[model samples]
Target: MQSVVEQFKQTYGRLNARSLGLLAELYTDDVLFQDPFRRLEGLGALTRYFAELYAHVETCSFTFEDEVVQSQQAVLLWTMSLRHPRLNGGQPVVVPGSTHVRFRHKIYFHRDYFDAGAMLYEHLPLIGMIVRFVKERV
Candidate 1:
């Protein structure tokens, strides 16, 4: 059995689109992914979700700084960097988050985490304004 840290260490670190595809190979057809805005099920849905995110950013990558890996459960402490031309190119929007995965032997059953606001909405111009307004008002 690959440890949680090992799975991440082997897949991430030098992340690219191809690496993303490789990681998806570890997800089952019925994978479940959760985040601030979306609770998506199945690897197909997960792939589409990730693809849409990649479309908006010039470059995207992740680095795992800390981790806690058990037999079937793993938690990764990491930061995702995205280069948004509208926000600031190459400025790197660093959002610290964790991906908690439940492993079904070699594939993932559940994999999810992260703050959407910090990673996305806060980095947009008009969108950021709306987020701030909504936060302040609500």
Candidate 2:
């Protein structure tokens, strides 16, 4: 089980369009994946979702900082360093988040928790300033 969790982290950290085919090994056929932006059901949908996410991305990588495993579930804390053409002036931006995964033989469900503003909203031009201001106030 812990091995599965490690594989999950390593696989995702190096994930790319070409490597998307590896999803079959890390997820079940009916895997459910959700994040602040969208919810994807099934391995096929997951592939498409990732394709779109990385379309404009220049580079993206993840670093797992912490983890906790119990039974069929695991929680992993990670920071994603991403560089995209339309975000943050194409410079790398880091966003901290966590994922909760449940699996039997392979991951059947995965949920990601992160601030959308930090990953997207705060990287916009005008909206970025406003979002940053609001975040500072909070």
Which residue pairs collide in model 2, if any? none
TM-score of each prediction? 0.78, 0.93
lDDT of each: 0.72, 0.91
For candidate 1, the 10 contiguous residues with the lowest summed lDDT are 11-20
Candidate 1 lDDT for residue 46: 78
Among all windows of 10 consecutive residues in model 2, the one with the lowest summed lDDT is: 1-10
| Candidate 2 local lDDT, 33-87, one digit each (tens) | 9999998899999999998888778889998999999999999999999999889
- Which segments of model 1 are wrong by more than 4 Å? 1-4, 18-20, 130-138
Query: lDDT, candidate 1, residue 54?
Result: 62
lDDT of 1 at 91: 78
Residue 42: error of model 2 in Å?
A: 0.8
